[model samples]
Target: MTSKIAVLGAGSWGSVLASVLDENGHDVRLWSYNKEQVDLFNSTHTNPHYIKDHTFSKTLVAYNDLAEAIDGAEYILFVVPTQVTRSVAKQVAEILEKNNQKVDLIHASKGIEEGTYMRLSEVLAEEIKPANRNSISVISGPSHAEDAIRKDITLVTVASRNLGDAERVQHLFMNSYFRVYTSDDVIGVEIGAALKNIIAIGAGALNGLGYKDNAKAALMTRGLAEISRLGTSFGANPLTFIGLSGVGDIIVTGTSTNSRNWRAGNELGQGKSLDEVIDNMGMVIEGIATTKAAYELSKKRGVDMPITSAIYHVLYDNADIKETINQLMTREGRSELS
Candidate 1:
């Protein structure tokens, strides 16, 4: 079933989704904040900003205006960074609401906002009035932009408050190589999506420290343990963290050098400060904020997230990496699966 899909943000992930939908015979409109990037999509049929080698389909259209992008959109996918989801949603809501239009929404972003600590859904609920909240969903999992663009077999989950809507979203993007699953666990989905980056940074740091797979595996596993401890406090299903969005995402992001979070962590592990690493990456690494948020969350929930706490100290408190590792190792011994 062909549908009208609008993808906001022309970054790697957004462009990949646009290309995927276009290849699936849907009417895809890709919205970009950068006018020159939009022009590149319009003229050369390539998104040089993200995927330079892959040719975008003719069915894909680029628009600089939000109105043009969401015009009659059946599914509006916001692919912006977590920090900007609210602002972008506000703009989207104003534009669509003014036009007397309503569309199903799916967010591909992952990260809780700083001060508000609002999950993407909370941000949507805030930007969109009560009337439009039900239309929003979050699609996330192990798929990376680079792999998705190459037509690899990528699997992800679309979580919605409404199970039917989740199913609708799942069906909307299921193609030969792209498989979509439906989940009603929005918190589990979003938390897993957001928290994995923190662990990825830890993994990257491990790599930078020339640590072994045993260390990476331990960090990755414990990372999710803490993620769930906090997620459960926020009403997420404890088991959902074991699913694709949780453990699945953690494994992929934590290990992949292509991951911005991991790359940033690698630099951090190599002795660069947070400012220096982020400056070099030249992009928003969600893990840094997530690490901070996780620190707060762990305190609030009384969950002993030693790993997350160590990460917080290393990043913001100037704790040495070797010292952090020693602290983690020296913590009171406990069963692995308690």
Candidate 2:
């Protein structure tokens, strides 16, 4: 069946994913908050600000009006920054109620809400009225729009509490170049997605500090251990950490030059201030907020996430990177098998 998909937040990932869906023969309507961006996408079929020089699918449409975007769409995919997800959800809820529409919700954003510390799906549940909503699914992994645009072999997971919904998204997005896997472990997928960015910041800092490959490897390895510890505390399957949504995401976000979180961390390691990094990136770095939430959650849950705490202090408290690294290394030595 030719399904109608509405994609909210026409950023790099959102735009690219819309194009991918359209390429897979679905009718896609992309929504942008900025009227100028919507007009540009409609006129030129390109989002120069984010995915420059890449042309969009000919059948894909862009809209500035939320109502138009959601009109008759079967699935609504949100790729907005995590911080603004609630506001967007409220707006979507209003539109859905007014139009008497019930649609499946899918979010590709990765972050924990700063104050509430809620995952993206949780935020959606809180804001979107149940009667107007259907199944909720999250699509996350190591997939980057830059690489996906080039038709690279990308693997990601579609997770939901509802297995049928996960399978639906999996089938919708799956293709030769982009493979999709389904899982019922939404918490694991989300935690892995949110927390990996924090580790990537540490990894990027290591690179910025002129550390070698061994240091990066150690950071990635220990990073996963801490992520697994914290995720399991939240009722997530421990094995999910080793899956595409967990380790796969950390490796890509931690290592890729295409990763905004990594680039932000690299800048921090090279001596850029948080304000300076935010001003320069011109995009929301999910790790900054996720780091704060993860640190707070670790403390609340009594989970030992030393690396996450260190990154939180560096970003929030202006802790010295070298000093933090020394403190971590000089801490009472423990067995790696622990």
Candidate 3:
């Protein structure tokens, strides 16, 4: 039986995933807060906001109302920006209460919020009822929306407290071009997704600085270690950091031009101020916020994350890239072990 899938965000990733599910023969309701996006998807069969080039199928229905989008849906996909995730989940919880419907939640967003530093699923669990917590799953990995929309082969991980719930979503989203693996470590997956963006921004800075592959390689390896340190500090399995969501995701986001974090870093590398880069890009770069949150989390948990700290200082404290590099290189050394 086909599942009724509802995607909450209309950005590139959301639209791309909705398109994949539609092609796989599921009934997908793609929701958006904007009226123009709804009209384009429903009328012209194209998403002018994100994936403007791809043609959406008739199975993809665009909804402007949250209740209508969630009504009778078997599964909900949360794809909103990290900053708005909590608010949107609260709104969804209210609608579910009003309509008396219960469904599984699949989150694909990555980034920690400013104040809470909570992962996306944590924010959802807090906003929703206790009973709804069991149905939440996180879908994350190296999947980039730009390539996915073009039907390029991509791999990602689906994680949840319940393996069955994660596998259910794995089957729902897997297509000819997209593959999904399962992980019991949702916390690790979320950490990997959130932290990789900051590293990507750092990578972009290196690229902007005209550094070669040697610099990128060192940054990627050292950054992965720091991300794993933070994840382990939070009780996530350390091994999950080596899986698809960790090193795999870090490499994709840090290297790809399609990554918003990497692009933001690139602009910063080119000597543009943070405000200038944000204004020019005109999209939410998850790294900027995640850097700040991860920095705080690392300090609170006593985890050693020199790379994240450097990126944080560079972006937030107005520290120079050259000086940040010197600081990281001069940090106290420690033994490497599990």
Candidate 4:
């Protein structure tokens, strides 16, 4: 079955998804804010700035205009940065209202809003009118664009309050190399997806500091504990923290050089300033912003996310990384399960 899908955002993941959908025989319009990128994609079938050397399906089209990209689309997927999600949703709402159209909302972006701490789906719900949307869903897991583009065996979970909607998306993306699973733990999946980036940054920092596997292993384990603690506080299923979006995501993002968040933390650990790292990466390092939001959320929810707080201090307070590590190592001991 052929469907019209609009994928918003032109970053690495977004472009890869657009290409995947195109290969799935859907009419896909990829929207990018940059006109130059749109033109380049349309002309060359490649996103040189992000996914260099990877060719997209020729059937995939790129649009600079948001409304045009979404026109008559049945599925609207948001892959933009979390901070810009609300603004883009606002524009999408206006366009949908004007066109008297309704579409299912899906987001692949991962982060909590810095001030509101709302998840991406929550931000979409607040902006897009209920009348203008059918169902809201999220896609998340350990899959990375750099791997997926090579037709790597990638698996992800598509979750929605509505199981049928999740199944629908599962069919849309599943292929020989891409496998999709359905889950109903929206809160757990989304929380795991957003918070894992923070842990990944810590993992990269460990690598940058020449920490051994023992330290990396400890960081990842404790980081999952922090993720689960915070996630369960928000009514997420504890079991979901062990699923693909949770432990799997942390392992991949936290350890991989392909991860922008990990790379950013690596640079920071090597003594680069946050500004320097950001300017050099030329991509949104989600963990940096996510650390701030999660830090605030932990305080509001009174969750003991020591690692998140440590990363927050290093990134925001100019605290010495070594001192922060010492503080974490010296903290009073408690039950591991606590």
Candidate 5:
């Protein structure tokens, strides 16, 4: 039941997951590109830069060198931002090649690559050699680090093409507070994980504009339609959208202040420039980049995603938020199921 796990990325979510594994009696090695962060976590057993007022498990170790962190690990978890996923995966592949070790891959990060429009799993698959990889799995849902660290009842789905691989991850992170479900719909899970951030941005913008629950409710409902539209177009199960990674993720990220994508949208709706919001947040607002990727992807796939398009224009074209909302409101009516 005990395994050596290398968690690459020392951000808020990564640290929290590493702590969870450590508490589960696993040997967890957390790697951060920033040596200071690794040193800080090792010395104080905390990551104040991201998650404050919380102490990490003492058994969890921090490493600056990727090779050292994954030296003997059986599972490698990628929790870095989407933009850096490919680069980090390349490094991981090289290390795995030199060691001639193959490990199951699990990524908690979500986003579609802007130019390639590939899902994070796809990006990892491309970078990590097939010989050095066992199975690629993704853990996604409504769970957030802020809530998970408090031992809240958090639920997520671990999905992969291989059912056995998913079950393996399910047992790895499941606990009293953290519940994990298994799914074979890797495409649906990853799409839902990546696209929900776009809807969350719209939800935050509505809140910033002083919209009521009725309006927020409408936005979320229609946003689900857009997510499902594109997801199913790419061969995802429609039922997957109603599950944890889809509607569950939307409700949590879209309505809550804890989501960086929502917070970024709130600032944007309040008349702050995208640059200002991004600079102030000092974190990766995935929806901003994801909006662009999804927009292009929807166009290429001939899928209608007005919400994603509106957010893309606002973030990239500097469109007026209020006007954009009005435009969305005035769009021609269609059947609810359409």
Candidate 6:
């Protein structure tokens, strides 16, 4: 039952997932784009930048070469940023073509490409060669890398066009602390995973502005509504939004201080500039780019995503946050169901 798995991206999430797979008795090869990171992991079994407190599983291996990490592996799990997924996929495709290898592709990143507005799975499908496509799946939910490293109980949904593919991934990662649920609704799962980050920013912003629990509660509720609307407009199952990838994700990201998007939004609400927030974060704040993509996609699809639009204005156009909140509050009242 053990499989050779190549885990790309060496970030906190990637390292933690590789660790989890190793714990599950898999042969894991962790890959990083940076040579120094690979060296650090190989020498000390620790990633000071991302997971400084914990050492990696002794059975897990690290590699700087993508081809070396992917060679002879049966699965390739992508944990890189969404914006760079296409490029990494292209490289993986080239390597697969060269070696005549095919493997299942899984991605955990959550974000939509800015201009193309393609979901992470879509980006993989477009970039990866068809011959190398075994099946593509996305594993996502409210899970964060920090808690995941601590073996905190986490539940995530795995989605694919093929039911068997989803089940295969479920068996691979399911454990006492880590649980996996299967769904065929890739559109809903990915949409929920991507859009919730934007709303989390708004939630954090509200908190930073000294808004009470009432305001945060209202923002999260309305945020879910708009998320459902946009997701359904894209042919996603409305019910899927009620699942882990949807409301479950919103609850965690929107409320937790560990969320990068929420943290960035909080800083912005405290009167810091977006650039300052991002620079201070030092990690990719996915919501910043995803907000623009969601806003543009909502308009193109004729879906009313007022919260997304408002966040987009604040982040991209330097719109005043207080004025933006007032404008949102003043919008003509509608039925709660609407």
lDDT, each prediction: 0.88, 0.93, 0.88, 0.94, 0.93, 0.92
Better of 2 and 3 by TM-score: 2
Clashes of each: 0, 0, 0, 1, 0, 0
| TM-score against native, each model | 0.96, 0.98, 0.97, 0.99, 0.99, 0.98
**Could you give me the TM-score of model 4 versus the true structure?**
0.99
Clashes of 2: 0
Query: Per-residue CA lDDT of candidate 4, range 298-325, in tens?
Result: 9999999999999999999999998999
Of models 3 and 4, which has the larger TM-score? 4
Better of 3 and 5 by lDDT: 5
Whole-model lDDT, candidate 5?
0.93
lDDT at position 134, candidate 6: 95
Where does the lowest 10-residue lDDT sum fall in candidate 3? 329-338
RMSD list, candidates in order: 1.3, 0.9, 1.4, 0.7, 0.7, 0.9
List model 3 lDDT by residue over 1-338, tens digit each.
59898999988898888888888898889999998879878998887656757787877888999888888888999999999998899999998877777889889999887778788888988899966434889989998888888878999999999898889889998877899999889899999999999999999999998998999989999899998888988889999999899999999999989888999998888889999999887778888988999999888888888888888888988899887887877877777663
CA deviation > 4 Å runs, candidate 2: none
lDDT of model number 4: 0.94
Clashing residue pairs for model 1: none
lDDT of 3: 0.88
Clashing pairs in 6: none
Clash count (model 5, backbone only): 0
**What is the clash tally of candidate 3?**
0
- In the predicted model 2, the residue pairs found to clash are none
Kindly state the number of residue pairs that clash in model 6: 0
Model 3: colliding residue pairs: none
